[model samples]
Target chain A: MARLTLDRTRQQALSVSVATGAYGISFGALSVAAGLDVWQTCALSLLVFSGGSQFAFVGVIGAGGGAGAAVATSAFLGLRNGFYGVGLAPVLRPMRGWRKAWAAQVTIDESTAVALAQPAEDLPARRAGFWWTGVGVFVAWNAITLLGALLGSRIGDPADWGLDAAAAAAFLALVWPRLAHRRARAVAAASSLLALALTPVAPPGVPVLAAALVAIAAGWGHPRPEEVPE
Target chain B: MSAYAWMWVAIVAAGVLSWATKHAGHSVPESWLENPRVHRIAAFVTVALLSALVAVQTFASGRSLVVDARVAALAVAAVLLWRRAPFIVVVVAAAGVAAGLRALGWG
Candidate 1:
């Protein structure tokens, strides 16, 4: 039974890695459109390694936002990864030095989700899920990012290629799965409205931060229809 | 600084902060993260930020808002998502919509 569960976990992680990593093409192409050189686009994938943050960084920069705003927006988008690390720590066990650092770096949404969804008592299965998904995503994401960057460069005006729309679609897809919760739906609606309202008056990145305040506010306290699974 | 120079700085700074945020979770006492409120807030924050990105990407151009092919493409993408299409298919369809609209000179 344990072996079977472990195999299933691995299969889940593998599929998730491919699905999630493939989105890096959008990230890669969009980063170039956002004005990153091919190498810079690749570096962002290698270093930042989070989908939402990478997109946020490029989105802000592409819109003529300053470096401060770009970094700030990307950082805000990345905050969830930390929480994932917190959730995964016990499952992953203690580590030291480089191994610990690598583990920390790979604690992302797909990895954490795959790990946590495993049978709670199966530490080995959970760990297998986390590492497989994380490392697999890392490799695939970086390689595809390079390919997208190259393709994006030769594609002419981004608007002509509808890369801009693709960018929007990517963001929508990302938030789609999370909107199943009632409160999350409310937060998303509120954030979208707040962002739209602030866009004209505010600086490029400020509106997004302002939108986050809505989530923080709504998320405080509890039991407004008990929170649903993420 | 030049735009590219600024991008480099942003890339490095964002990278360090992102890594640190992830590591902090592992290093912190697990008890700290046990709060339901914290998890809820984090999850909501993810939804909030991504939705905001969707808005900005779809509608805003510079400091102003505009209606364009991107909007139509977003609508298409939303429909595909409602049908549970694959991510690549959703993305490609979106790009195709926008690109096709632009070719028609209709935006």
Candidate 2:
């Protein structure tokens, strides 16, 4: 484990939080496109706090999917956070009952990513990364979402300014760093192609899940050294 | 139901479901967490699902996939990210490129 200084972890947390938080600006604008009021958009960021699910929720609604479909899509997107919780449980198990519940509420992609990005054995830095990134993103995400929603109607067509593209760009930026290896890149490209293929035939949000199946299939059937990081 | 009523219902349901996943994660045993299959699938899911998101957002509009300036902006963002640019720069750059192309009537 590299002796990661607290300062470095804090820097990483702040930077990721800011970047991920800025994503809320576009979300606010897009939610308006989806027919959500500013308060509704703000509430989603504040209460839901999960980026993938929030995006899926609004995207589904924006496309005229019913509320049931929107909820289902968001729920599916949120399942990853559960997986993240499993990974973090041993590390964060010190909390019990309500504190544990609260911790779980904030256990989204950014915090988990920062925590996991640290060298495996550096417990202190990893913990610092989790909490700092979680709180930082929460604060920044809500604030920026409000700003974006307020600006949404005035922006005329959000697509004209590419705010409609903001959510995709944000998620892509987050996924970009993980593509450092060849196999990960392959998985990404393959999965993207799968999603693209499914887009025309599948219902809303179904493509993303079908794409996840590609990874699961590869993982269970063909276990290669590069494909399975240890 | 009114749209507002359905909206609240969806929010509450999604919130409960989201919290359940996270809370359930905390209760899983360490042995299960360390399984090779689980680990590998988790990794794959991260890459694959997020990529799907990018694809969906970049090209998929409503029910169809459409190419537009957003794709070019995503390409620019990917290039900047590959170059190890800061996170904010990459995001801002993508939006700027997309907006620029639109302003030029090419979007």
Cα lDDT tens digits, model 2, A43-80, are 88877889878988999899999999888888887876
The runs of at least 3 residues in candidate 2 whose Cα sits more than 4 Å from the true structure, single-residue gaps closed, are: A1-42, A51-70, A86-95, A112-129, A145-152, A155-170, A221-227, B1-10, B86-88
DockQ of all candidates, in order? 0.48, 0.55
Q: What tens digits encode model 2's per-residue C-alpha lDDT throughout B16-104? A: 88889888877777677678787677667767767777888899877788889999999988888778786567767887888899999
Which residue pairs does candidate 1 place in steric collision? none
Cα lDDT of candidate 1 equals: 0.78
> Per-prediction fnat values?
0.78, 0.69
The 10-residue segment with the lowest total lDDT in model 1 chain A: A221-230
Runs of candidate 1 exceeding 4 Å displacement: A1-45, A48-100, A103-159, B1-14, B25-28, B84-88
* Range of the 10 consecutive residues with the lowest summed lDDT in candidate 2 chain A: A221-230
Candidate lDDT (C-alpha), each: 0.78, 0.77
